[model samples]
Target: MGLLLLLPIVFVSNALVPTQRMTPWLRDLTTWNPISAVTAAARELLGNPNPAASIDAWPMQHPVHATPIWSSDY
Candidate 1:
């Protein structure tokens, strides 16, 4: 059940597939997804190749700052 639920979010994130091809609404979701923020933060902190997003959404744009926000129970 958990895997099934998580699968959709994982698939929709910028993790596996590039979000560039998605529709605007979906792209928005991808940008706001905590998974995306985490991924970006990880890539950035690890000095990996993080792709530049044209969207400029807060999470993707500022993942290092966004991760703690997403991790908190608000």
Candidate 2:
């Protein structure tokens, strides 16, 4: 579920932002926005504070590093 939110952000950041003309605020959103939908869904499904188990391999460079919140520990 968390991966779902990350998907769009990652797509926009890596694909759209480079070629498109977006405002600074919009660019900021693209960079920092959290995937609320995915987070909520994960919370519902996992019933835990941590949603790391819900992430998959595609969007994450290293699936093992993917967590509910961004972490440099990865």
By lDDT, who's the top model here? Answer: 1
Off by over 4 Å in 1: none
Residue 3 CA displacement from its true place in model 1, Å? 2.3
| Candidate number with greatest TM-score | 1
Q: After superposition, how far is residue 66 of candidate 1 from its true place, in Å?
A: 0.7
In Å, residue 34's CA in model 2 sits off its true spot by 11
Cα lDDT of model 2 by residue, 11-63, tens digit: 65423323124576664453343443344334445664433223332322222
lDDT of 2 at 27: 48
Off by over 4 Å in 2: 31-71
Q: What is the C-alpha RMSD of each candidate to the true structure, in Å?
A: 1.5, 12.1
lDDT tens digits by residue: candidate 1, 1-74: 99999889888788877777899999888989988888888988999877734557878778999999999997
Task: Give the local distance difference test score of model 1.
Answer: 0.84
Candidate 1: worst 10 consecutive residues by lDDT?
49-58
Candidate 1 has a TM-score of 0.84
